[model samples]
Target: MKLFLVTKVVPFIMQLFVRFIYISSKKVFHHPKIDSKEPFIVAFWHGELLMQPFNYKRIRPKGKVSAMISEHKDGEAITRTVEYLGIDSIRGSSTRGGAKALIGAIKELKAGYDIAITPDGPKGPRHSVADGIVAISQKTNARILIFNCRPTKYWQFNSWDKFIVPKPFGKLEFFIQEPLDISSLEQKEAKELIQDKMLLNAMK
Candidate 1:
């Protein structure tokens, strides 16, 4: 019942509200690289989800983009929300069906879809990066770009990552770091580097 409500019913209402609110008041400041066409992996902390999708849709290349979502009740809502934004979603998490999720992500990347992941998502230790993102990048030979969203006005959920919801008509700042190429690095080294980059980019 909970999943049904979140996946089917709640999204219709939330989508309407979020679209109206986001469209009414949202300003984005971006520093995107000129060569953004190449397929790459996008990494962002989970807390900044609200505004990240909007910004990504603005700058992401004209290709299929997929986001990794947890197979939990909350993920149902997120799946719907992402779909409304016209981005595809793959349901799996580090805790459940992780291997399959990673394989699917790699296949998507290979198929030319830029992938998006939340290193500290599905339940997080708040800003911590998991190894899955790094593994996917290494396996797929995809470059990783770390992105973040800073809101001038928003509500902070008392969750592990302090999830933020930008208020309508508010200003949002998007920070895009240089892409980290993982094709050459060892798995352990790549994970460390990506984790550090994700943390640095997410900090205020």
Candidate 2:
């Protein structure tokens, strides 16, 4: 009974929180070369997950976009939020079921679904990229695009990732880095290169 109440009531409250975020985040997308319809992987830090979904919803790609979520309680909450926004979720992480998740992402990409991943997510060393994204990109020949969201006013959590919650009606800056092609590089090299690019772009 307790579990049932928590699941139903907690998500209802979270849905309100998500609505507040959607209304507050004013997104400015910086995609000069890539069109919204193009199939590519969007990599962002987990801290910005709250607002990233709003940005993706605005973009409205013709294909589905899948996000990786860990199989944890918090991840269950996140999966609910993602589903609310009409985006698909794949449950896994670097430590558990990581390989399976990567393969799933690859298949999603091959089926023409644009994928989004919070590289430093589910549990993080804070802004670090795992090899799964790189592997999926290389296997699927998808371009990886680094994205970050900067909010004008927000509260930062004390958590590992310092998760941000934007104040209602605050402006958000969405930065999209140039796409990195993984077609030529080997898996090891591609992973390092993508990680470096994400780190560098996330700074601004």
Candidate 3:
């Protein structure tokens, strides 16, 4: 029963809720032009995750996108939710199935999919960068693109990442930072670079 609710009921409700909010909100994206043809490792904070599928579709609908989702129970729901929006999921995270996840992500990027990741996820030091994201870039030679979203009015959860839910008819602002090439950098340096860029571009 719990599995049915988590995998089926939750996603069904979430898709309706997300779509309603997105349709009612005023979305504003701030970014320079980017090539749709080039693949990127799209990184965003877990707290800012709810609206990303909509944001990604609005910004780069033509690009094939897939995300590395954790194997946590909640992750299953999220994977189903995003699939409704046409985004693919590669199951795993920093804690569980990390090796296989990284390998899958690298393969996806090489195969021309924009691999999305919430670097501080599956459990968090909330909003902090993890080494695995950098390692994926190092192994795949993929550039990392930071995507951040902030809403004018929202509910903030007491969760570790201070998760947010945008209220209806609110303004949703998105920022897409310049992509960074970390393919040759040391893991520590690359992690810091991505973290700094993410912090600098954070909308709120």
Give the 10-residue window scoring lowest on summed lDDT in candidate 2: 54-63
lDDT of 3 by residue, 30-142 (tens): 87577787888989999998998877887796778989999877789999999988899999999998999999998998888899999999789987898889888887778
If ranked by lDDT, best first, what sequence of candidates would result? 3, 1, 2
Per-prediction TM-score: 0.90, 0.87, 0.96
lDDT of each: 0.79, 0.76, 0.87
Q: Write the per-residue lDDT of candidate 1 for residues 1-204, one digit (tens) a residue.
A: 976787788888877877776777756656556465577888888988766667677776365788999987668888898788777888898987798889889999888778889988888888777889878877777888788887778888887889888777786778878778878887778778877877775644
Leading candidate by TM-score: 3
Q: Which parts of model 1 have CA positions greater than 4 angstroms off? A: 1-4, 34-37
Give the per-residue lDDT of model 2 (tens digit) for 13-52.
Answer: 7778878876666767765466655678988888877777
Leading candidate by lDDT = 3
Span of 10 residues, lowest total lDDT, candidate 1: 28-37
Query: Model 3: clashing residue pairs?
Result: none
Clashes of each: 1, 0, 0
